[model samples]
Target: MFDCIIVGAGPAGSTAAYHLSNQGRSVLLLEKKSFPRYKPCGGGVSPAIQQWFDFDLTPVVDNKVNRVRFTWKKGDPVETELDTTEPFWMVQRDVFDNFLVEKAVEAGSELQDNSEVTAVQISNDIASVTTSKGKFDARYLIAADGASGAMANWLGFKEAKQFLGAVLEVETAVAPAERNTAKFEFGSLKNGLLWCFPKSNGYSLSAGIIRGGKGKVKDLEKQLTNYASELGINLSQSQFYNYPMNLWSSERQLHQNNALLVGETAGIADPLIAEGIRPAILSGVKAAEAIVKALAGDRNALAGYTDTINSEIGSDLVLAQRLSGLFFQFPGIAYRVGVKRPYAGKMMSRILCGELRYADITDMAMQRLKSSLIPGRG
Candidate 1:
């Protein structure tokens, strides 16, 4: 039996495998899809994630964006140029995930791709996983499977709240000027927002309904095509993809017996911005740490993983949820009063980059926007 078995080779699973293997533990990394498989994502990630690994990650980054442009219904643009030491990184999920897995392999973890897990059971402190390829056993198991995956339910966790999100990938050559800018368009759809991020050769345009609406979540074709037209882009070469976003809705236990949930299976995506990769990586590292402790005879180590996540990142999501409700409700007013301010965009970017916290501005922002809508509630 391996020391640990990690399901799903996304950012979370690969990260856990890397850290665990580097610490001299045997790890088995499993992926349902083949290497370099395409994923529907915006591909924007924080540079702050470099702190988790000791290796250089520049080889996997496609572009570094330092400018943020915001618009309302594809008009009235407000731009912010970040002055931080490291700009946000844009990556293709296929290359990025494969690179992470390669790092784990180099660190002594075994990777098994195109192996779908058919069954999983934990009994007597042992995890028995049966996949399409074969059956495996491990001392501990991590369910890093995504939002649509069944690992969480099989392990007996509550169903995480899922929201609709869509993406359009256009592969036309991009101008150098547009390659460094990340654009966000507000007020284009009901209970949602749209964003377009630049890659080295092309762009990823995406949309999502953030504040709990099921009305037109799946009807994103109209929203994205119209937005693309406004930006003077042709959609003839665009590849459309949609997926469910499992945002971090509430704090809950992340461990059961010798199994733990990471990435979307844990419902750890950001509710406000729909950022998944950064937090996913964070959970992976923390889960590895907990399992290592469990092997060393810490009875409460697995439970500690849940507490660490709640205190370190989950609390901020609560503030993000509050802000999301008010912002999407009065997006126009919030845009004019909040997103247009000189320092507003910078603060939001800093929060996504892990350099700032929602606590620093959520109260002030909610009060400001609430007063704008209510007229006399100060």
Candidate 2:
């Protein structure tokens, strides 16, 4: 039996594998898909993730965008250069995920790609997974299989509510100006937003109803098409995908028995921008630490993981949730008062890059938004 079995090879799972193996624990990482697989994402990652490991991640980062351009319904742009210690990173998920998993393997963690897990259970206090490849046993299990994965259900955690998110990716040559700027458009999707981040060889355009309620796939695709058209991109050579995602809604028990949840499976996606990579990696790092402690007879380690995430990440996201509600409800007004200011725009970028916290600026932002709604201030 392995010390830990990590489901899914996304940032969370691979990160756990690397750390656990580095600490001399046996880790087995199972992935449903082969290496270099694509996922529907905007591919925007905070460069702040560099603190997690000593290995070089520069080779996998496709682009680093310093400039940000925000628009309201494809017009009235508020553009500025992000003033953070490091620029935002743009990556292709396939490349980035594979690179991390490879690092884990290099660190003595075992990886079994294309091994789709069909069943999971806890028997005799050992967590076991029955995959298409076969059954594997572990002292601990990390459910990092993402929002759509069934590991949460198998582990008996009341699943988080999810909404459909869509992405349209296109491969084409881009000018240097476009490559260096990350783009966002508000008021194009109801209660949601559309974002485009550059990849080394292409662009991934993502849209989702992040605040609340469900979204029709057709509606998201249509809006993305229109947004692409407005950006002068050709639709004939693009691929579109739809996936379900869960954002942080409430604090819940993330640990059960010897099993724990991480990444999207743990409902850690950012409520405002739906940022996933940094949070997923952060959860993975913490999960590995908690499991290592548990293996050493730390009785409260797993529960502490839950508490740490709830307080550190969930608390911040709660602020983000409130801000997201206010921002999405009145996109036009928020764009004018909150985002249009050059400093505010840069601060938003800083938040995304992990340099700033919502708690740092949300109070002022809330007052600004609330005041703008008064009389003729807007």
Candidate 3:
């Protein structure tokens, strides 16, 4: 029997396995897909994740984006140059995830690729996981199988509110001048934002509604294609992929009995930008820490997981949810006041780079707006 059986080999699962194994816990990491499999993502990661890993990630980093261009309805763009000290890094998820799984293996975690988890059950103090390869029993189970994973449903965790985001990753030569820049387009859709991110060879262009709805998938595809055409690039032959972006909610349970949910399964992604890497990794580490404490005679360790997440990650997500509603509901005001304002754009870039939090910047933007509205108050 393993001390911990983790489902999924993505960033969250792999990070949990690595940390657990490093502490001498017997960890079994399972993945539904083989290594280096393509994952649909904008692939933008802030440098803040550097604090989680000890090794250099230069191998997987495809580009360092020092500039960001924000546009509203394909109108005049507001561009901002990021701080020289810290810039956003982009990577192909396939390469980056494989690298992380390799690190988990190096840390003594047993990885089983192509092993799809079929069922998960927790009885008393033990968890039983049934996978395609075989059955495994462990003291604890960590679910990092992403938004569509069934482990959460099988284990009876409260359903999280999910948002759908789509991406079209294509390989085409990009000019040197445009290679290191990232672009975000607002007001293009009624309920979503569009993005074009630079990759090593080409770009990943995507569009999706922040709050998901049916019948918009095809519209997102058309929007992406039209946007690409405006930039003089054709995505007719490019590979297209779509995935759900799960946003965190206080009502969702993080741990139930001996089973714990992490990553997108737990809905920890940023609601505003739909970014998942930072929250996913942070949740993984925190989950491991909780399991470690639970093993060390603290029976209530798992119970505190939700509280910890609420304090650290949830507060920011709550603010992001509010900001998302405000921005998307009033895109024109957001564009004119927030995006067009130099200070606001700089703060936004800082938030994107993980230099600042959404709560901080939201307050700053509100203060700026107040100052602009009432001149004598300043």
Candidate 4:
């Protein structure tokens, strides 16, 4: 029997396996798809993620963004250059994910690609996972199979109410002026935003919209197409991809009966921006730490996971949820009066870099809005 069985070899599962295997514990990482498989993502990673790894990620990083451009409706875009020592990094998900899984393998974890998990059962403190390849028994099971996976249902966990966000992305050549700059446009969709991120070979243009919004998916696509055409970019020749993200909720149950959930399975994406990579990696690392402590005879080790996430991750998401509600409620005012103000964009850039928490900046953002909306107000 393995010490831990990790489902899905994405960032979360691979990170957990890497840590567990490095501790000399037997780890089995199962993936439904082959290595280098495509995953729908913007692929923007905050520089703070460097704290989690000891190795350099330069080989996988497509670009280090130093500038951000924000737009509201048809108004002139406001551009801001980040003044930090290190900038945010962008990568392609397929390459980045494969690299992580390879690290897990190098750390002695057994990786089984094309091994889709069909079912899981826990009894007598042992977990039995049935996959396409075969059945495996382990002391603990980590569910990192993402939002679309069925691990939560199989484990009898109640489905948490999640804010569903959708994305449509394409890659195409960009102009010299667009290189190395990330762009965000709001007010095009109700309660949503569109983005353009620079990739290694081209630019990735995407549109994100919250579910049950003013427009449907088709409307969002039309907006993106029109926006691209306005910029003289042709998306008709590019391939289109779509995916959904499940935002985090505090009420979600993370662990039960030696089975723990991590990554999208636990709804760890940011409520405001739908950012998932950093939280997924962090949750994976925290889950591994708990598993290690539990294996050392601390039955209550897993219990601390709730508190840890609350303090480190959940707190920020909670603040994000509140800010998202306020921002989306009046995106136009938020954009014109808040985001366009001096230092406001910088604060957001700092937030994206993981240098400032949303909880800490909400008040400052409100004050900026007030000063802009009401003349002679500080």
Candidate 5:
């Protein structure tokens, strides 16, 4: 029997399989889509993620971003700049994810693409996975199948909470090279953020707009047109990718029996931005490390998965959820406030990078609120 069966070959599953197999464990990776499949993402990677995985940008990066802009959804579009020593990079999901899986393969993980897993069961300390190809058994099973993870749902685990109803993403070319800044629009969409992340060849335009539990494609298109017009960017020939934004704060439980959940399966998205890739990759690696530790004599090693993930990601997500609610409450007002309030934007950035913790954020927010409340303190 294989040591582990990792379902879904996204960053999480592939990372897990990579680490486990590198340790000489027999790991099986299954994916429903063929390699180089498309993924709906904002595609921005913080500098911290590079250090987290010892990632080399030369392999999969599409562009390096040194600037960011945040505009109010319904308020005046004020911009902020951070000329940091480090830069955030963008990569196409297909290239980035395929590269990661290839790394896993190089490390010895067996990958089976275009293989959709239909069922899974645990018996006698082994998992029997039934996929389109056939049946296989493994000592452990990891569900990294993403937002609509069938395995987690089938197993009755708590799924990622859908905060914003729908997300509209489009890729197109923006002519002016000077406007190559990642911009976040805050005021127009209620409780959502619209963005334009520049790529090497084009830009990825996206928005998380709540549509009363459903999304309107036409309305989203109109909004995109308006945003583009404001920026003087043409998008008549843009390619679009639409998907749901499932944020994973307040995640209930992730582990059960011999099954462990990672990535979107564990609901690890940023509630504020609906970002999940970096966290998914980080959690996947941690889950694998946890499993490795467990198999190496610490019976409680597997039990540490939840603890480790929470310790690494939970706090920031909580704050992001809070910030999401605040911004969604009144996009215009919040965006206006965020422009002069560098801390607000910095908090968002730091949270994404895992440089700040929940308690730290809570204290800072409370202090800021207290200061604002004091007469003449501002």
Candidate 6:
């Protein structure tokens, strides 16, 4: 028997394993894919995430960004240069996830890659997990699998609201080669945004629509090719990859019996921006802490984990849901105007960076929007 059995060694699972092992607890991390396998993502890391890990930029970062371009169909695209020392780092997901797992192993956690967990059951304060290799038992279990996580279903968690995210990313040799900026095009489709992020060797472009319809990489191909043409560039020779966008909130109750949930299995992705890496890491840490505390004497340790996450990230998730819903509802020129406004952009940035709490904004806006009628309120 092990102290803890963690399913899916992604950001959340690795984070929890690292923290638990650091505290002298035995931890086992299971991953279905082989180590260093490619995972689909936007490949952009916020500067804030550097606080958690000792990021060796030279080894993984493709480029640094200090400028952002925002565009809309109503007018010419506007570029904003944020003259700050801080730069957003672009990294490949395979390298990033492997680095996180390596840290956990260094801290004493045991990792099992290419080990598919087929079944999970919790009884008498112990979790029995059956993987392709064999059966293992542990006092605590964490489901850190991605959006299609089977563990969530096994635990009877409700399905997330469906949202479509289709992105075709590729690196191509192109001119104007200073890869130091990211471009975002808005109002292209309903609840959709297009992205262009530069890497050290080349540039990557993506077009995506969330919650509008099923995303097909083939359909995105034309959009990306058209965008490249407008920039006087061609990506006919680049390597292409696709990843799904899962931006839904998991049910509030993430714990049942004795099993706990983390990462996408817990619905940690931000609904508005579809950002998950940072939140997944934080949730993993919190889950480990809660389990540890509960083992020491708190019988309701899993419940505490749920409360801690809700307290820390609940308001943000709420605001994200509300804002995404509002954006999708309007889907017009006015929405683009709001995004281009420097104040709105900064406020949104603050929320994403964890510098501001959504509850504070809610309290302030309640008075102004109260008369306008709010959804979900009778």
Model 2 per-residue lDDT tens digits across residues 85-199: 9899999898899999999999999999999999999978799999999999999999999999999999999969897799999888777779899999999899999999887
Q: What tens digits encode model 1's per-residue C-alpha lDDT throughout 1-378? A: 999999999999999999999889999999999997898999999999999999999899999999999998888888998767789899999899999999999999999999999999999999999999999999999999898899999999888878889999998888888989999999888888899999976889999878765446346878888888898887778988888888876788899989999998998888889999999999999999999999999999999999999888899888898899889878889999999988999998887677888888998999889888875653
- Please list all clashing residue pairs in model 5, or write none if there are none: 72-187, 73-186, 73-187, 73-188, 74-187, 191-328
Give the Cα RMSD of candidate 4. 2.2
Tens digits of per-residue lDDT, candidate 5, 1-378, equal: 888999999878888887788789889999998997988777876656665454465668777665566766534554545445455667788898999898888889888999999899988878899999999998788998877668988767765555433333444654565434677776666445677777766667777753234357666667766776677666665665566565655635667777788887887877767667888888888888887886677777767888777766876677766755655664544454454476666665554445555567665554554455467873
Kindly report which residue stretches of model 1 are placed more than 4 angstroms away from their true locations once superposed.
Answer: 215-218, 376-378
RMSD of each: 1.2, 1.1, 2.2, 2.2, 2.8, 3.9
Candidates in order, TM-scores: namely 0.98, 0.98, 0.95, 0.94, 0.89, 0.87
C-alpha lDDT of residue 236 in model 5 = 65
- For model 4, residues 296-362, the per-residue Cα lDDT tens digits are 9988877777568777898888878777777877787788777887787888888888888888887
Candidate 4 accuracy as lDDT: 0.81
Q: Which ten residues in a row have the lowest lDDT in candidate 3?
A: 369-378
lDDT of all the models against the reference?
Answer: 0.90, 0.92, 0.84, 0.81, 0.71, 0.72
Q: Write the per-residue lDDT of candidate 6 for residues 1-378, one digit (tens) a residue.
A: 888989998888998998888888899999999998887676776656666655444466666776777667524666656544466667777887898899899999999999999999888888999999999999888898887778988978776655555445556664554476677766765566767777755666766565565566666766666666666555666655555555644338777777788877787777766677778888888888988886687888888788778767765677766756666556553344456556655555555455555566654433333423446541
For candidate 1, the per-residue lDDT at 218 reads 46
Stretches of candidate 3 above 4 Å error? 212-215, 249-251, 367-378
Candidate numbers, best TM-score first, in rank order: 2, 1, 3, 4, 5, 6
Q: Please give the lDDT score at residue 208 for candidate 4.
A: 63
lDDT of 3: 0.84
Instruction: Note the residue pairs that clash in candidate 3.
Output: none
Which run of 10 residues does model 6 get worst, by summed lDDT? 363-372
Candidate 5: where is the Cα deviation over 4 Å? 164-176, 209-218, 350-359, 366-378
1 or 6, greater by TM-score: 1
When summed lDDT is taken over every stretch of 10 residues in candidate 1, the lowest stretch is: 212-221
Whole-model lDDT, model 5: 0.71
